[model samples]
Target chain A: MNDLMTRLELSALQDRYVSIIDNDRMEEWPTLFTEDCLYQIISKENEDLGLPAPIMHCDNARMLRDRVVALRNANIFEQPVYRHCLSGLEWTGDGADGYRCQTSYVVINTSAAGESTVFQAGRYLDHVVRTPDGLRFKSKRCVYDTSRVQTLLAYPI
Target chain B: MNDLMTRLELSALQDRYVSIIDNDRMEEWPTLFTEDCLYQIISKENEDLGLPAPIMHCDNARMLRDRVVALRNANIFEQPVYRHCLSGLEWTGDGADGYRCQTSYVVINTSAAGESTVFQAGRYLDHVVRTPDGLRFKSKRCVYDTSRVQTLLAYPI
Candidate 1:
């Protein structure tokens, strides 16, 4: 596809990725990724400073699967919804078999049941490709700088 | 100067800026910037996500000086030292009689009575120029990504 089409596809993929959590469709979350993938939530400071730790890390598609399963069955937390706002999609470069895009995002949580708050804000450094299933992520790095999340992040942002 | 020498000068300038903070010479911090400047601490997410909020902002030399004075005479928090670690300095391009660069950093804080903890991590998106006062920053955007901060950031990171 051309650059414009490629960008359009990537945009749709991101929209679908976030909509799953926003609509409580956690089961389908992992379907947007490659079989072997990485989903990490790290502080920008750590990445920039070359630190080797992440707040949340799903090393493979299986790990992401396990996380959702745990969220559904094991984990316990307040009932809330996250509205993720994303923009600033700039092309970084071509990856091994895909393209990389860097974006900034803000995840706002409403516990109108409690209080509305800006939950998480950061950058999404992503690598996406045209998989058989369409544009899927090889890696999605959610790098935030909130210092403290309003509550626990029970679902993917 | 050549690209190599220019880069070296920028590196030294950064090193000096952080050292001034680490050594408790907070009063001297503002001298590193041009008279009219923008020093903002914002999340990469906010910038990328297109949000118009800053965690900390010193919009001009006056504001920066005000911050240092407040840090010294007004605000109260943990008495600590910050050791800034920086890397990833890539020259973006030449600006109007200056240069722009992007860098990653980690600020480690140590209280007088305890061990050090990583206070913040992020990138330094900066604009520098050869002013009459030597190499100085026209703008310094400290964009970090940490979901939660360790404590209140009273000093410039």
Candidate 2:
């Protein structure tokens, strides 16, 4: 695919990923990644300092599925609605080595009382590759700048 | 133009609009709108109830320009840098009645002391038309879900 077409496809992939999370379709979230994928959420401060301290990390499909199961059945937290807004889609490299891309995102959380607040603000660093199914994330790193999370982050941001 | 091309152009237009605001190019902001245009920032609660209450409203180019001047010379507030993240670009109608579209946005504010926070989270409802120069907004309404702004909104979001 051409660069513009690739960018459009990647953007759609990201939008769909966020839609699944915001719409509470957590079960399908892991399907967007490869069988051997790296999913991690780390603070920008730690990431900048080259620290491997990640708040959430999943190395394979099983771990990803386990997290989804945990969130669905084991996790205990207030159910808040999330609205994710994304922008600044930039990518380097090509299809041969998989695409390395970055996109800024902000996730807004609405409480049960209907009060909305910004839950997480950050940028996503992704390594996406073409699979038989379609574009999938080989690795996805969420580097958040919000030093202090407002509440227990049970759901993926 | 084809729908994809139109969508691409519209997305670029919106990106440029946010870049100007984030970069503090206030003087050039009015030029992106029509001579007679409407700009307003309203809370989602009030907007959903069909209330006409707006925290900030400006009609015509003169008002927009005056607001820029006020922000540059009259407004008293800390200078916080803004980074606007946007997504969900959708439009309806046609070129005849102009394209009516909605896009989600989240603005992150970085204070002078280097603290980043989600300043505003919202969606923009816009009516854009083709002009000799390019696409210009005939009307732009920012319906913010963050009902209570964190601080005095001295600049455009």
Candidate 3:
């Protein structure tokens, strides 16, 4: 694909990923990733320090599915609506490894009581590859700025 | 222009807008809008209720320039840095009315002490038109989801 097309596709893919999560379509979430993928949410402090500690980590598609299953069944927490606002998409690399990209994101959570709060503010460091189906994530890392997490992060950011 | 190019241009325009604000280039802000333009920051609640109340509203370029002057010279408040994260840019209208566009935004405030916090979450509803100076906003409306204002909004988000 051409550069603009690639950007548009990648942008759409990012938007779709957030839309799925925000709209509670978790079951379809794993389909956007490769079978062997790494998805982690880590703090900027930990990441900058190379601590390797992540708030949540899933190494494979099955693990991602399992997390979704747990969220739907085993996990118990107050249900809130999530709205992700993303920006600053920049494609940094392209070649045999596909495309290395980064984008900024801010997620807002609204409680069942209708109180909206800024839940998380961060950036996504992504490695995306073109598949027969489309573009899927090979790896996605969320690095969040430290300020306040408010409460338990029951959902993927 | 083609749709993709138009989108690309608009996306860059949005990014530039934030960069100017985040980087404290207040003098150039009004230039992003047409000679006669409307800019307002309103809460989503009031927007949905059809109330015209806005935290800040500017009509015409002169008013925008005047606000910038006040912010730079007259306003007295905490000096915090702003970082805006934006996403989901969509063009909703075109033709003589210009391009009606929308994009989600989250502003993070970092105090001089280097403490970062999620300050405001909102979406920009913009109407952009092609002019001699490239593309400029004919109208820009910020509809914010307010659970907390934190403190005085000294700078434009």
Candidate 4:
């Protein structure tokens, strides 16, 4: 694991991660995290109510895999796609084996019928570590400030 | 002016700054920013469009004073008050004179008629520095992810 990754490398890392989702390679999504990692998508309304539930709460990579399985095999929804635009990737600190950084993101959802809308806008406070594969997320917390989500979040934000 | 402000100090600094707003001491608000500061309230829609306009844009400490003066002496609206709850205080880096941090905030509004609603939910991306008068913001970017602002944004977010 390389300890000295440039800012461009980090930005490219996230670009690849988002491409996985956008290209519908969801089962590979879990591979982006460490075996023991957290992935949660939180809403401000739930946060204000002091509720600790997430729209998608995957406590570990295994759970994330299960979510991907569900998304690919079970959950039913219209064909909507997510396109993420990220900015402000600022370094915060270095974790034990990785780096901690934050970035602002906007996710646009395009429906099967080709109607596109801004699905959500939020920030990603991520802990990333270089791995045999590449820069993998040790933990990824997606904090969405959007008060009301237009539709149920069927994909990992 | 101390350059060595601890994380707790930074957090408390922001808490105190917001308290001034909730307490209706608008005149004192300008003191929170440096003489040449940037303050703006931006919506996700506008941010996505790469628009330069802000709902409220105060380019410097003087503009902030004018805003406070207008708020106290001129602006007309039903008595709506704001209650802010901030979370996720993250230190991104040290600024030239002080530090840069980011925090997520939710604002609830209570009208004079005893009606309360969630006015906005957003994140504050700030550049703060210590000054002769304690901590002052060099720049304050309030990014609101709420789909729509319920009403006119008359006060500082």
Leading candidate by TM-score: 3
Which tens-of-lDDT digit does each residue in B57-118 have in candidate 3? 88899998988898988867877789887776767565466798877776778888888866
What's candidate 1's DockQ score?
0.02
TM-score of chain B of each: 0.93, 0.97, 0.94, 0.90
Q: Can you give the DockQ of every candidate in the order shown?
A: 0.02, 0.16, 0.16, 0.02
Candidate 3 TM-score versus the reference: 0.66
Comparing 1 with 2 on TM-score, the higher-scoring candidate is: 2
TM-score of 2: 0.65
Please write out the lDDT profile of model 3 over residues A59-109, one tens digit for every residue. Answer: 999999998898999767875567798778999666478899899987887
Q: What is the lDDT of residue A31 in candidate 1?
A: 89
Q: What are the runs in model 1 whose C-alpha is more than 4 Å off? A: A1-157
Error of 4 at A74 (Å): 13
Better of 1 and 3 by lDDT: 3
Model 1 root mean square deviation, Cα atoms: 12.8
As a whole number from 0 to 100, the lDDT of residue B121 in candidate 2 is: 71
- How good is the docking of model 4, as DockQ? 0.02
For residues B17-66, could you state the per-residue lDDT of candidate 4 as single tens digits?
78988888888788888999999998655776998767888888999988
Candidate 3 ranges with C-alpha deviation above 4 Å: A16-106, A110-157
iRMS value of model 1? 13.0
Q: Pick the winner on TM-score between candidates 3 and 4.
A: 3
